[model samples]
Target: MPAIKDSRIIILATNGFEQSELEVPLNELRKAGARVDVVSLKEGEITGWDKNDWGTAVKVDHTIADARVTAYDALVLPGGQINPDLLRVEDDAVAFIREFHASGKPVAAICHAPWLLIEAGLMRGRRATSYHSIHTDMENAGAIWEDKPCVRDGNMITSRKPDDLGAFVKAIIDAVEENASARVAAE
Candidate 1:
């Protein structure tokens, strides 16, 4: 992997996203010189789910209808029970995830965000990890489920929870910096 100063990453989420899951990777990826956009269903702001209640509102940089998959080097999905649940049902969101992954771009999902991957049909026969509660979901999606902090299979990455954000963020940076062909060969 080379320097990622010019890498553009999309952090796709919506209302009820887990606070740390979105913020940690967004801030860290930016600090590492990657351009990250908080793309959502709408253009205003989306509130996060801290733990039990609502957290801070994160500005939406672009709407799903407007964001082009070709414009980004990677996609990051932040998880919370409600976040992925809401996103997986949106046809546009699922199409974006599928097309992004099919293009061989990096796609990282943490916690329950793998639900979106499941919706995208990107989990079959892949090695992955997610929130313990979603182990069955992953298995049902044909993913080789594990309990690790971070699991990287080809250009896709998955982690257990906010506690695994460090590894998850690092994985995305690595994936972005790595050669696209190399990632496909890694599959």
Candidate 2:
């Protein structure tokens, strides 16, 4: 397993984000020694959507408008039916994701989350997987869609749905750890 040590991780989401989808992977990242920051569409706090009810609130460290792509090593986009769908329509969120990808930083998205990738136009020529319903959208975006637990292509990783959280979190951790190790070796 990869220990992040001092690596910095950024999670981007908004209200209605899938509760466990964000929290589980985030907690695991922190446990492995990564410094994780939660960002949102606005400042203050954001609520998560549990299975059929409201979930815990996560603090917002920065608003999408003020986010800088170069400040973090990795990015995570959590999904709920409404969260990423709303985010995909936000210009700042789309630009932030685009910049992050252009910077060659690891970006992980799960469930309906890859909708944002489609909006950012970063799915072209990449392999990804998401909730089954978005398979056509992903295919239309030029991504080679898969029906696997997780699919990783270069700095991008995608998983099918909330149930795939285990594989989702593991993929993010592995990406972060791999980057951390590479950075350490270069120093």
**Cα lDDT tens digits for candidate 2, 1-187:** 3467667889999999999889987898888788889999888999999999989899999887777887788999999898998899999899999999898879999999999999999988999999999999999999999999999999999999878988988888888788878777888
Looking at model 2, which ten-residue stretch has the lowest summed lDDT? 1-10
TM-score of 2: 0.94
How accurate locally, in lDDT, is each candidate? 0.93, 0.90
TM-score of each model, paired residue for residue:
0.95, 0.94
Model 2: how large is the Cα RMSD against the reference? 1.6
Candidate 2 wrong stretches, greater than 4 Å:
none
How well does candidate 1 score on lDDT at residue 166? 85
Candidate 1 per-residue C-alpha lDDT over 73-170 given as tens digits, one digit per residue, 9 for 90 to 100: 99999999999999999999999999999998889999999999999999999999999999998999999999999999998999999989889988
Candidate number with greatest lDDT: 1
lDDT of 1 at 96: 94
Per-residue error at 52 for model 2, in Å?
1.9
Clashes of each: 0, 0
